[model samples]
Target: MTENMNDQLDASATFSIELTCPIGLENVLENELHELGLTNTRLGEAQVKLTCDLRGIYLACLWSRVATRVMLPLTHFNMDSADDLYQGVKSIEWSDHLSVHSTIAIDCHGTNKEIRNTQFGALKTKDAIADYFVEKSGQRPNVEKQQPDVRIAVRVKREKVTVSLDLSGDSLHKRGYRQQGGMAPLKENLAAGMLLRAGWSKNSQFSQLVDPMCGSGTFLVEAALISLNIAPGLRRQYWGFKGWKQHDHRLWQQLQDFAKNERVSVDDLTVTFQGTDREQKAIAAARENIKRAGLTGIVEVSLSAFQEHDFSWQGSTPLVIVNPPYGERLGDEMALISLYSQLGYWVTENALGGVCALLTSNDQLARQVPIRPEKHTRILNGGLECRFYLFPVVEGSIKRGDRQQAVMSQGAQMFANRLQKNVKKFKKWLAADKVSCYRVYDADMPEYAVAIDMYDDWAHVQEYQAPKSVDEEKARVRLMEIVTAIPSALNIPETNVVVKHRQRQSGKQQYEKVATSQHEMIVQEHGCDFIVNLKDYLDTGLFLDHRPVRKYIQDNANGVRFLNLFCYTASASVHAGQGGARSTLSVDMSNTYVDWARRNIELNEFSDRDHGVVRADCFEWLRKSTNEFDFIFMDPPTFSNSKKMSNVLDIQRDHVELIDLAMARLSDGGQLVFSNNYRRFVLDSELSERYVVKDITAQTLDPDFQRNNRIHQCWVFQKRG
Candidate 1:
């Protein structure tokens, strides 16, 4: 039987109530119910069932920040068919629970094969209740869909229907504070759950919270509310019990008044919250939301990047939380890998005694975080399965079998020693020449047979494909040892090191990709930027051997219209753009390479209209293009057999035809610089009849490649004058 809203009740009387929450947070909700004085509580799947009085139910609805709904059960009965459901619901004391003047609604769940339609079941239950009320009085209570006074809930599971009255309307998760949450914002309740799982509570003496990647300040506002002892439901105006026929309005008002009184009154508090972001719009939205939450100046927010965030706070270790960008559409595991690894590295190096939690839905990317997770909790963020990587901000205690315990073999030791000696020898030279990208070791020891190039702080290791006579097992062991030795010796993490196999190619095999790491980065050469991918292609977009070649073009490209053939990444055209060239054109056979060239130019703040990247074979393009140039930098591949090309290109056999085709488009006094890497390429002697050729191969050799002058060859040509 049910009582009226203002009906007096025994303070000690307890009733059956069920609390529903997110699946993984049942334990948290259980503890919360215990704190609210609910007795004999038991956890069931995504719910907690307890025995509590009307006041207990009111407090559960008013104080619970994690629970979604609070429901009070009326009865449990078997229902085999629709009539059984209707009769079972009608058997309950309808007058005790509803008034003919109050509006009502029924929410049905589950389905029996006999009564498969939920709406149909709900309609029958509604009829049973309305008819009972109409018979008791002259008219029936009206059915209201928007907000009913008495909300009925019937759940069917295993042919047993449990009828309950919902006491929390529109879900208790909505705190009514958010107005401008940014893209993919984390729900307020989920954010609070994350804080609780990360060992946060208002009872703590002193605490601080910082979300460096805060999108809309959900976490910060939740933290502020928690620290202030403010109940989540204190500000809400309506609930499921407000308009009920037997609603305990006085009891609900008492609960609300009690919760309001529990809020921390002191304006100045010890607890603090801060947030930082890279987007100005996100920061603005977060500010507006914070103001809506009445935490305007309490929670500090600024536009700061995680890279520049200060991990050190004034007092004890603060909790650092981050939700890095992730999704399937965001291509390349490399970016997320690098980002997580960087975040982990920063935590290890900076926040020694602090606590950090990272929430992400990616497992492969989670492995990329350098430090191991101490505790992982699975939760839902907007229905996406995500995990909280909880760990202390300290260096891991190295396990014996982990990478930290790797011991070098004799072969690897010798290889590492040689690399160290080479680095030592070129350290001063690289600095003097302003070289941030260079080949540190080019097989100085024949047995190692590997070329190591350093781009800024990262090392790219290329192993020569061994001959058939070499033992495969022995080579494999040696390569593993080398990988272990390189990162350890260079004092960089293993994630920063990329490995590749270098071998002699047949036809166009060298241009293909082995893996799609998409680990692209920008390296500065002569004050200009070029994109390089360490894992995507055999050749990292920029050619370190062409350092001097680009410098030469930049020096002579002033006020000239430039054209680049076989412009792999437009590194040379970027130099031409830097040299005040009015406009430029570049041609390539691969669309991938053309896109790479466009990114390189844009990265250096150059427009793509004047410096356009065209995807076309130079052979076909040189014959068709009417665009004339005052300067031409033509560096063709030694050989190519692309199926997309009209004809195969072999530099040694077809140098004359390619040069003749290039010379036709050049202005009379313009310079034509031709380069190739074919070790035995011989310029045709007959070409001296039409133009004067000057071999600048020796002059264009930068200091880095002087030891192997055969790495490339170059020639400058001009029309006979």
Candidate 2:
């Protein structure tokens, strides 16, 4: 072409370059480019355009922690149709960048009228490039989608296209130190941007860094690299420039050597990094990543919960950066309120004069931290809109009074006394039966209406919905007192106490999940082990009141084919399996409960072909199955109109048909146990006349349910002799 064009194609010559990052990080990327001595920069949406030489581009790729890709723009043209795109792409001198033998790939973005989809645009661009090479040298390079020799990036906006040569083949987030990350891991570049936003520097006043909820040590590793002046891209093995014709291999090697020499050892660094995570897998992953990053002893990580971890340091104020789990599903956010509150309390009480930066997607959860953020910035992570809050940790700044202890009223004290008395009463029975999961108190006192249940070391408190005659503020205050009294009365930490408002449920609302924390543990009840989650759902997987019913099934389940219909979590089925039932089948409509049942069965070492779980309507399954069961148990919901069901179910109205279906599946001497929580339910007289029906409600009531005798009604049905 021209002499000026030849100079522009040279590796040492200056040209216009663009550095792209996540959308909200434009300003951060600009400042980073300035730090790299490329000052002639203009900011665009998600990109920073600048004029720099090839060495400057290499430096940007090596050191720019926030930028996702470093691109060198070749040309821009207006497009009216697909032919115009083809012509514009073909006009470029392709030989200067790569030869026909090299493999190539195209990544197109921002479709126009001529290109309605990204795939079509990428295909058209590939055709143009292939045609250009074919016409020039009578041969065309092959297309490689995974790892191409040379990668071209094309962006179209408002019928205008910009073609650039991508220098960073993979996204800059792959720092090569992390082999795996925990669920919903933060991107490495985003972590670096967050660190920079929190004002973390090598010579800053902060001498220590702490992350209480550190998942896989992203923030700690990024912060250590930044403090030691280590280049982020040094560990990466591949780049797009390696296949380009004009790539300067000698110059790139020199840059790498310089970066290696410039990095300081962790011993010379002043800041000490510490991290703690509640999950063992997370801690293991973090340790492996830290070892990979060559900071094994320099950065320390431990397996500890957020509420129990110690965040103290011996020197100046520490900067705490936390990227806690923000809950991806609908009900997940409800369980994180206490977690955020604990975080805020720790930062304010323990880290005075320090700074804290928190990242979360839920605004309500963020506001629960009891600290007013000095700055709040909106950012996008993994396509979820999130906010990064920067708080200057100071004393008495938020004015949240006395979070350490709740002022208990006289009513609360009475409730606490009742709780103590109930525990004392159940102490002998619980120990004798080896039952760790049981109801301690069931609203014995009218003024403080709450039911307290203990599962191992944790306490689950559910408040009954107050009447309309009760004042709202008074009810709220009473709830606060109840929550505060529960931990002290039960001798458990406040973090182990889970609180939920109990209300009358209809249809599928009772089965709906209230939280997504999935914090589960194994608890022993009646010599059987079952999984229970106090924080995630309205009811723990194990039904405490059904201890007697499960005991009956376990006592009578020898050598019989057992059937458990409407088995929520299949706890009864587990008991039957342990009772030596020849074969067992558990059926439930909800997929979540079915999966939970599978886990329960597996936990009890009953995951064989004999014990099966089916996710289907119990009514439908009973009608379809031809196999007979010798022992059957059916405990349907009081009322349900689930869309998945063929017909609505009302316990009082449909008990005859349900009982008949279960009886049809029973063998000659098989006995069917029927139960429901409908307090006002009455059995049909005609069915009682047709079959031998006997009320077994008294036998099913355990000591824990004796105080509330009407909690459930039970009956046993069998054929006449």
- CA lDDT of each candidate? 0.78, 0.84
Q: State the lDDT of candidate 2 residue by residue for 339-410, as single tens digits.
A: 676778878777778888999888866866777789888889988899999888876456466563323457
Model 1, range 572-630, lDDT digits (tens) per residue? 99999999899889888887788888988899888877898899989899889787899
Give each model a TM-score.
0.66, 0.74
Best lDDT among the predictions, by candidate number: 2
Estimate the lDDT of model 1: 0.78
**Deviation in angstroms for 460 in model 1?**
9.4
